[model samples]
Target: MRFIPSLFTLAVCSSFSIQADNAETAIERITVQGDLRQQSLQQLAGSIAVVSEQDAKRTSAQHLDDLLNQFANVNFSAGASRGRYIQMRGIGERSEFVDTINPSVGILIDGIDYSGLGITGISDMAQLEVFRGPEASRFGANALAGMLNLTTKGPTATPEGKLSATLANYDSRQLAAQFSNSVNSQLGYSLALEQQSSDGFIDNTYLNRDDTNNIDEFSGRFKVNYHPTERLALQFIAHLSDQDNGYDAFSLDRNRNTLSDEPGQDKIRSKALALNADYSGLGFADFNGQISWLTADSDYGFDEDWSYVGIHPDEYATTDRYLRAREQITLDYRLVSTPAGQLGGSDWVLGLYVAGKDYDLNRQFWNWDLWQADSFSSSLERSNAAVYGELTTPLNASWSLVSGMRLERYADIYSDSSGNAIKNHDMMWGANVSLNYQVNNQALIYLLAARGYKAGGVNGDALAKAADGNLTELNSKASFKPETLYNAEFGVKGSALDQSITARVAAFYMWRDDMQVKGWLNPDSGPQFAGFIDNAGSGRNYGIEMENRLQLHPQLALFLSASWLKTRLGNYITLDGDNLSGREQAQAPRFQYSVASDWYITDALTFNLSLQGKDAFFYSDGHNARSKRYELLNARISYQLANWELAAWTRNALDKDIGVRGFYFGNDPRDGYEPHVYEQLSEPRRVGVTASYQF
Candidate 1:
């Protein structure tokens, strides 16, 4: 409550803080690299948030967990070993247990798909961009809602090397090193390696350990660029991440302490490679092509009962584990019309994309009797083929027109050891059209309309389990149909006060048909929960997003980002009559906001302060429980000299208890299976110091 006055003061002063500072660095024009071609972000018709390289380096971020509050309307699910799944605009998956999912928010690193793996390292990222709309025309169905892109640092014209280290409470530590150089005018490369580990915040009273939910992560990235001829250029990127973490999160008391005897693991090892080539030797058009491959192996499991045996009379003991392997390959090629190929003064682009992916999963469920335990395995193969194109032209002196379309054929095959075989195929299309009006030299107003789609998916073994239990009230459909979304948006964006201030404001509305909603069913009569997806008739979401920054002086800058959103679910009765009609969608908070200020006290001293808040939201579609509204504060201060720097930072400075995940279910034996609000908590107060040296 005290911070509200300070926020008002900063907001008022920032409006009048536009005085020119000769020494202050001008807010330069930013180009989004994820686009088909280089484009100025300020002039784009859609909404996006681009975190510059300097902003990433200014924080004590080791992985994605530390950077959540930096973006508005963005959230992540941490029910597993990692905070892996992400949500944008309250649209995305919260968890994955049995069925294959089509992600709403796509993720990419250097244009290679890494969706659902949200906890990537940030030590070497040059920039981070989050597009907050349906980008189907650009990236196809995977980008139904939007995309998260990370562009790592590229080779430098001059040779440079840096070493950095960090130490924090809870036995947290990290070490990283990076180097980049151009050997010649025709060749260049960059390489980075990092290792980070921490004794996570969970305390296990039964095991007498505080490191039960620990973290051990390693990451590396390498990139190279070569120009063999005057008209051709080639680039290559390789990335690897190995993570081994514990997942003893859920507690009987819904706090930091745990009593489970067997704490499960959340681990993954992934390797990916991408190659791209650009050529201009042709006369009619230029060629751009990309191909990539990714492979990953992961294991996720947890103790079914929150307490160990003997804690209660006749206590049931159980554990569940899953091992998954995934492989994916993708190719994208584009032809950009040269001046010679332009028709009627309009530039155009044509593209072809093909992707294939394979997923395999093995699950082990152990009950009290080893002979009665169950084993399950499943295999799934998915493929996508699409042809997409775009055209841009001047409609008038003040208004420009941009339109694009994509046609994709999606196919998948699934089978399980339980004699269940299912296949799904769908033909989907998406398109967008926009008109940009140049209001003046410094501002632009635009209106856009777009359509997006998500392919249908099967419920794996959950369907059979439901039928076996004769749960007639549960969703009877073995598979769900495709989902389509129609969106309309308009906004004004540009610079002001001689490029000292940058602001973007937008309002958007979206309508969904055949919406896929999450539901739960008891595989047996016991207190067990298995997830499934059911198609609802319709839904809608509308919101406004605002982001602003002002340079008060050469050494001071202030920023504000906020969103007001509303969502409603359609009438449907799945999950034994738990119809969530007319209710707000889960995880769709009504309001979210973040405020920050950066200041350089002296030539060698710097300070940064930030406050972030989010409104209450429902945890799941199958339950009525809601998370509490909460606010967090973070601060960082640094001192630098010639080629050396030292900094200290703290997150959740007030040590507030906040829930990251919540559920209303009955799991207690003593209470006779009475439902209670169980939750997984976020990390408590964390303080760390970092040092870096450059050579």
Candidate 2:
């Protein structure tokens, strides 16, 4: 609370000392793709943040997680080798086990879905947009909380190429290169490749290995654009990624040291292809279509007991592993009416979407000390079809009305090695309505109401269901109910000081019914735990967000963003007789903010500094454990000279102990079944230097 006043004071004081100058350029027009259409940022009704390629380079961001963590109301759970799970406004999943999960947030890269597996390479990205509310009408069930859209650099008519290399502490090395050009007047192409490796920041004393938790990644992307005729355009894109990383992170004493004998692996290999086409031959409307396919194979395993065999001779030491392979295909087609007055001064869009997914999982549990092994496998196939439409009409000179709706049908089939089969079907719907009023050329205000939906799925843990000893009970618990969200928001966007300053503020409230929540259950009084998903009664989340950018001078700029969130359960009760009606939702922080400043010392030199902070929050619903509030500092310096650039950067410059993930459960036998809090810390201070050349 005290920090809020200080931040405002600093902003006010800085404004007084800064003078506006036309010599410096301000970011006046930002184009964003939020609803499958490009719209100016100032005209958007919802809360969104955009990170450009220049910003990513200034911060020396190597992955999507690095660029996203600097924004307000955005956080990640890092139980794996990297930040694979994202939480927006405190609504997202932290981890996944045997049970199937419907992600609250959706991730898209060049129109291909990568929901739970967002480890795709982010090199040479043109821009990234983060939508902070339910995008129901645009994305349907996959975007209950929000969405992230990443656009890669497109092909250019002029030939150009870039090569860069980086070296950092802890034996880290990275190399990247890209080339784009036009082969002829009608065709253009682009290619990019990147490889990075590091001896990660963890020490395993038991195994005497300093590089037990290493990171190795490789990625490549190719894009081609062809304009066959004056009214037709076509594009093809392909991407491939391979990540092989270690996961020995936890320590008994909650520090940077581990004693696990069987360190685990977190690996993923993915390939994706997309084709897009547009035709404007019809004078009444424009047609656009996209076809995409993605496949990924992953192996995630971890040490069940973070200890050596001799530490607890009587207790069993185990390792749990899961191998998963997934394939997805999608087709989308839309037609947009051209000319505002084509249909009585109104604009409209109609779209059809279809998607199919196949997922297979194999789990293996090895009790090394006890010489026992258990194995299980499951497969799931899901299909979805939807039709959506939106209409925008002007009510008067200053007010406009927009309405949209989506109707979708989903079906899923699940089967496991235990001879259990489950089939389910659901019909989901989403809608949105908004009213916009333009106060002036420099300001706009809007109110929006939207609904979002997610389909349910069958539980994949066949062994746990069989252990219930009742076939009827097992069948009844096989499926969970769908979840829905209703959200309302009011927002304002404007610019001042001759467009030298731009700001946006929004407040939103969301009510969720039949909320899907995850928890672990103990079928018997043993050390084993079975994961399950069930529908809670209801929940609510309300929050306010503000973002501002000030171009103090041509050589200096300042940026600030903050959010305050509150979440609570309503009439929700756990299976263990715990009344969580009034309890706060897990991972819901009270406040989060970020401040950054950039200074150009000279025509060839620049410096940057940033600060990010987050308030304490609960870890999960099953436990009352909480994480401590923390802040991080980062700095960067760069020098440019005629097609060559050199930069140095440091992350976590202050070396703060920030917890990225946490758990509250018993794992060590020496503690005699006493539950304690365990946390995974973020990376320590890392210093690196990069050099790049463009031609």
Give Cα-based local distance difference scores for all models.
0.82, 0.82
Candidate 1 has its poorest 10 consecutive residues by lDDT at 7-16
lDDT of 1: 0.82
Q: Cα deviation in Å at residue 244, candidate 1? A: 0.5
lDDT of 2 by residue, 1-695 (tens): 45545444443343333344541354256889656556678766788899898877766788876777677788788868888777888788888777667888888988889888875567688889888888878887889888888888889999999999999998999999999999998899999999999889999999999887888999898999999998999999999999999988888768989999999998999999999999998888888999999999999998888888998755657889999999999999999888932578888889999999999999898632245898778998999999999888889988989889999999998888877787889999999898987654445678999999888988766344544353223443567898999999987776663656777777789998988776655544345665667677899999877788888998899988998889987776655556777788888888888888899999999999988889998877656788999887889999999999999999888888778888877776776756778998878888999999999
TM-scores, one per candidate? 0.94, 0.94
Off by over 4 Å in 2: 1-27, 366-371, 462-465, 468-476, 523-525
Residue-level lDDT tens digits of model 1 in 502-599: 77777789998988888886545365666788887888888877678888898899888888789988876766667688788888888899888889
Task: Quote model 2's TM-score.
Answer: 0.94
* lDDT for model 2: 0.82
Candidate 2 at 293: error in angstroms?
A: 0.6
lDDT score at residue 168, model 1, on the 0-100 scale: 94
For residue 476, give model 1's deviation from the true position in Å.
1.7
